[model samples]
Target: MHCLEVNDLVHRYRNGDVVLDGVTLRIPAGSIYGFLGPNGAGKTTTLRLILGLIALQHGAISIFGLQLAAHRIDILRRVGSLIESPSLYDHLTATENLALLQAVHRVDEAKIGDVLDLVGLAGTHRKKVGEFSLGMKQRLAIAVALLHEPELLILDEPTNGLDPNGIVEMRALLTRLNRERGLTIVISSHLLAEIERLATHVGIIHRGRVLFEGTLDELQRRRRTHVALATNDDERAIALLARQSIAATIADGRIVMPAMPNTAIAQVNRRLVDAGLDVHELHTAGDDLEAIFMNLVSN
Candidate 1:
């Protein structure tokens, strides 16, 4: 069974501003699913609905094959979440904060250290949470959520305040959790590059609606092929690509062609050579999530 499922889900504010419109999704167990969208795209609202933090206006949601509403307490116990931001008592030490949550959830004290170690905050447990860096706090929040050894983890904008190194650390920690503990993760982020690096599957939402959902390969396939080319004479390469009816643009001192099939690339190279242009370099650009995202939302 899928670890989480949503069918025709809908939600709206009290003023009747629809936030999510008939969305459906399925996340298999132990996969990292990236939820991508701009601000006010209803990504957070959808997560809130799935986590039962907000009332569902329509449709169905199930976690671990159990109806969310029917088994709210039971499902939540096995689910860990770090929503928009971490919440912790400023005056309390990290360990103390975790202990408080443990007392509330009735989780074992032994699990506190285990989770802290898992998130790389083992030695800093005695430090006041207020004194922790943004990355440390984020990791601590994750450690708190993981204290109960949840099977599923949901994080909304997990890298918001993180620096480059912190983001890398968080990614590593998440990768480890998925690999070692077999945990399923649902994460939302505005950072497309980060999503591309981490997610096994992705769902892109815009204007309270999902525009695309699929594996990275499928997403890449949907994107137009873009090739970055450099010849002995840049202008010659551009002219040659243009003659072949390839949409070419100059970027970073190279001629760029929107995604094209491999055969088309060879054709471009042959055309360039025939045109007396020495092909210095010719390679397809990586499928850019930012470009794909901009294209989807612009429409």
Candidate 2:
């Protein structure tokens, strides 16, 4: 079953500036879904709508077989969200902050220690939130989100502003939460490398529209690799490759063509040698995520 489903969602601000247009997404249960987009691409806006922080302007949002509009409270009861930044009382200790949320969410107070351990903040009960690192603060926020034992967690840019080590910790924590606890997570971020590392499913959004949505393998397959070759006679190499029905181009004084298997590359190399052109260098390139993202958004 889908953990979250968004269909033809459309949204705009009071000034009539459109933010989301016909955006649709489906996240499977127990999978980490990465919502990727540039700033102002409506990722956060969509999250807000899903959380019922703002009214849905158009289209439908369903969570775990329940529609957001009709089952807002029930849906929210099963969801835990940390958007943009974690709201915390800096003056309070980690335990105290969770204690406060436990009262609000009416959760078992005993779960506090368990969650603290779950987020790697154990034994820091007396440390005030103000004294914690940004990464620690983020984990505390996640701890608050988990107090209710919600089935789904939605986080927006959870690694934003975190240092390298902090990013790694956050990544590990999220992975553990999904794999160990069987919780479905939907996280939004513009960081391609982070998404590539952590997400089981990916959705690329650009200018308020979903450009692509699928598994990482599927997205990688959409990216084509190319072969770059340097030779003494670029012109003859191009002609020779064309004679074999291979399209070739000259870029930066090198003969470049779509990537082929090792055998095909060998054939091309042999053909070039037989044609009296000296093959100087040969390498395979392309298949970069950033390049694919740029190409998808630009078009």
Of the candidates shown, which would achieve the greatest TM-score relative to the real structure?
2
Please write out the lDDT profile of model 1 over residues 134-229, one tens digit for every residue.
888999999988988899999999999999999999999999999999999999998899999999989998888889988877787766666899
Candidate with the greatest lDDT versus the true structure: 2
Q: Write the per-residue lDDT of candidate 2 for residues 103-144, one digit (tens) a residue.
A: 878888899898999888988967899999888989889898
Off by over 4 Å in 2: 232-246, 250-254, 261-263, 275-280, 283-286
Predicted structure 2: lDDT: 0.90
lDDT of each: 0.88, 0.90
- Candidate 1 stretches greater than 4 Å from native: 226-287
Error of 1 at 283 (Å): 4.5
